[model samples]
Target: MAIGYLGPEGTFTHAAARELRPGADLVALTTQAQAIALVEDGSIEGAVVPVDNTVNGVVLPTWDALLGTTASRIVADTLVPVTFNAYALTGDVVPEVVVSHPHALAQCARYVSSLGVPSRAASSTAEACASLAPGEVAIAAPVCAELYPVATIATKVEDGAGAITQFGVVSRDDVRPTTDRWTTVFAALPERNAPGSLAALLTPLASLGCNLENIVARPLRGSVDYVFLLFVTDLDQDREASALDSLRAQCSGLSVLGRLAAAKHSRPDGASGIPARLAPVRS
Candidate 1:
């Protein structure tokens, strides 16, 4: 099966893909949209993409893409720890521009500042490596330092190796969870953003005893609307319909983004075999 992931080999996303669903034929694609598009179009059997990171919060456009992808269902979830490197031609001139994804640049902001290197964004981390010219560095996984002759310095530059990003196993077919998991997505805005309206909006979940894990409140840029995300403990058959009702009533002004499955997650460690947990923050 061809599986899609945020790539060039050696990227943290690729690392997560290897750990979660190893030996699947890997599809190196550009944006998260592009990756999901492949699945929608039947170009790939499944795809893995980053949903969140500890230090940086959400991956932005990816959030929108996940909501927008057609008939895509996240079958599984896993965490991948990121370790970035300053990759250039071995013993060659230092690079002025480092081609990488915007998320990679933010994850390694301090490194970029230390090296005084500017960055470029690509569809995928792997695609960025493919586009790099000679003498330019790429702040990506050393495994991603392809195009032959590129070198990597300063491995694991992210401040939080403890930091982890969430990825979804996407396919149109329903794949039941193999273990405990949770599902999160934006529901709706029942009303325009107003004084204390959002909190007043979510009072129903508490009433239903539907323990919410996190709530993301974002104002749609240049609009009076808002997007509210509820990261609740995974629901089962008895609770699914009622939970959907609660979501609809609570955020009547909001549009219905699919209530996809999410699993409880933690950061992975080599010895303990459990990923460290971040303090309860809005996912």
Candidate 2:
């Protein structure tokens, strides 16, 4: 089956896609949202989209897309180390301009500042490398050097060490059973302007033994209310049913995105170590 990724190939998402679905034909798309939308529309079997990063925090566009999706859910997750490398046309070339995705440029802010060159944003790091002009350097994945006609001018150009980006593999189909610890993700629209609304919505999770790993808020469109995206783990099947019932009674709406194996660090063997399984939707 074909899988979509935020790409032009040679991107971190591309790497994650390869790690998640080795030997599957990869379709490179321009944006993470586009990749996810394709899966929602059944144009592709799945798509790997960036969800979070160690250096950059949550990927906002991805969260927005998830909130909008109906048929698609994040079936699995993977992490890709953000190893930013500076590439140019020639090995000895000095760059007048630096180009990369905004997130990549921001992660390598200190390194880019040292180059004394203006940094421009591109659609993707790999795209920047593919479209590199004379006297321009692109901060991109190390794999770009092999895919594009560019030489690595500097390695590990990111400001920090061990920066990693988390990608969610979205699919419409229910995932096969797996044995790994699972986390259920969903978005909740709590009652607007109600006193103790947010707290009331989340208290049941703690009481039911589910650990809330991460919570992010996005503005609910055309309203003052916010949609809370929750990543909850330590779930017991028996307890979760009760938690869901309590959550439904508290919130105006809940979109159970997926129940996925907890993400682990990317291994040296290029495995994410996460497995996939689906839980019944409680929306």
Candidate 3:
């Protein structure tokens, strides 16, 4: 099976794709949108796109793409624990400027600011690593040093060690219910100027005993309307069905992106325990 990922090769999304399906054919596209487009058009089985990062929050472009598409749904997800480093073509010279993807720059803001040099955005961290000049540094993964003719001048340059990025594998079909640890849903509330309208939409989830993991509101393009992305956990089969039925009645538009089992190895503590929602039931 062929899977697509945001690339020119050597991106974190590419790494996540490999992690999700080892030994599968991987197609690299220039942007997350392009990868998603391929999956939506049936050109590829699935595509891995970064949805959220610990340091920078949601990836806006990917969020927008998810909202804009109707044929695609998130089928699986993997968390990539990231720690960036500064790479340079030559270690001897002080870098006059730095380059990396916008997210990388944001992740290592403190380190980048400390260098007191201008920074430029590249399509990906790997591309930035490959494009560096003698006095230019790239904030990239340590693997970039091996992939390109770059030296790791600085290591662990991110603001914190617990920097994790969440990548979603989007496909044309919805994922079947598994050991449901997380359910990702997107909904468009009826456009009303009333202050309590958003809260009213969320009331059903609470009543159904669904625990919300995260919620993000994005303004629809060219309109005052908004769409909400929600991650809910600790929902059993009954609650899941109930929540969706209630949501459908309340929302102008609703999509159940995926019901997924959390990645075991993706946990920050490196433990292989099951997520709380998927814990063994007591007799």
Candidate 4:
């Protein structure tokens, strides 16, 4: 089966796709939105796209595209280190303009700003590196230096140390979880506009022993209304069905996007005040 990735082969998403599905045919797509669309339309068996980064928080464009449709589900996820190398034709070259993906530019903001050059956004970091001209530097993965003619003038250019980006694999079909630890992403609309409405929606899940991992409210297209996206983890696998049922009852509408591998630190710990499930059983 074929899988898609945000690429020109040197992108971190390409690395993530490799990690997610080794030995699979990988197609390079110019944009994550395009990858998501292709997955929804059955153009590809699946696609790997960045969901968020430790340094940049949420990838807005990715989330916006995710909120646009519920047909595509996140089936798997992987993390890639957010490392960048400033590339040019020569080591001594002074760049007049910096180019890379917007998120890459942000991650390496300090380095890009130190160059005293304007930054341009490319479809992907590898694309920027591949298209670099004289006097223009691209902040991309070190792999790009080998993939293209660029030389790494600066290594480890990202602003933060130990920064990582989380990538999710999107597919049209439901994928069975590979592990018991998983996070369910779903969109919900409140029954009404009330101060306690949002709080009330969580009450049901709380009662069902589910942990609210994360939540974001995104504006609806062409309207002032908002849809809440929730990331939930169940302490007990047996309670998941009832937990979803409980949360759905509180919302006017709800859509379960996917249940994928939970990111590290999302699961409950002894220190979290939420007790970890002991002797957990799954069917």
Per-residue lDDT of 1-283 in model 2, one digit per residue for the tens?
7899988989888898999898999999987678888888888999888888866778888878877888788878876777888999998887799999999998999999998989889999999998999999999988887898898889988876767788888889766226446777778888665789899988988888788888998887798888888888766566556767878888788877766564645334454424445544568
Question: Which whole-number lDDT from 0 to 100 does residue 247 have in model 3?
Answer: 78
| TM-scores, each model vs. reference | 0.76, 0.87, 0.87, 0.87
Whichever of 1 and 3 has more lDDT, that candidate is 3
Superposed by TM-score, candidate 4 places the C-alpha of residue 256 at a distance from the truth, in angstroms, of: 1.6
lDDT of 4 by residue, 77-118 (tens): 877767888889887887899999988988888998899988
Candidate 4 Cα misplacement greater than 4 A, ranges: 234-236, 265-283
In terms of lDDT, the best-performing candidate is 2
Report the C-alpha lDDT of model 1 over 1-283, residue by residue, as the tens digit.
6998876666667777787688988877666788888887888998887776665676665656656665675667776656676666664657678677777777777777777766777665555666777767676766775544566655777544565677777777766554443454544565545777666656766666667766776666798676776665565544645666766665654432333454434544433333458444566
C-alpha lDDT (0 to 100) for residue 236 of candidate 1 = 54
- Local distance difference test, per candidate? 0.66, 0.82, 0.79, 0.80
Task: Give the clash total for candidate 4.
Answer: 0
After superposing all C-alphas onto the true structure, candidate 4 shows an RMSD in angstroms of: 7.5
Query: Model 1 scores what on Cα lDDT?
Result: 0.66
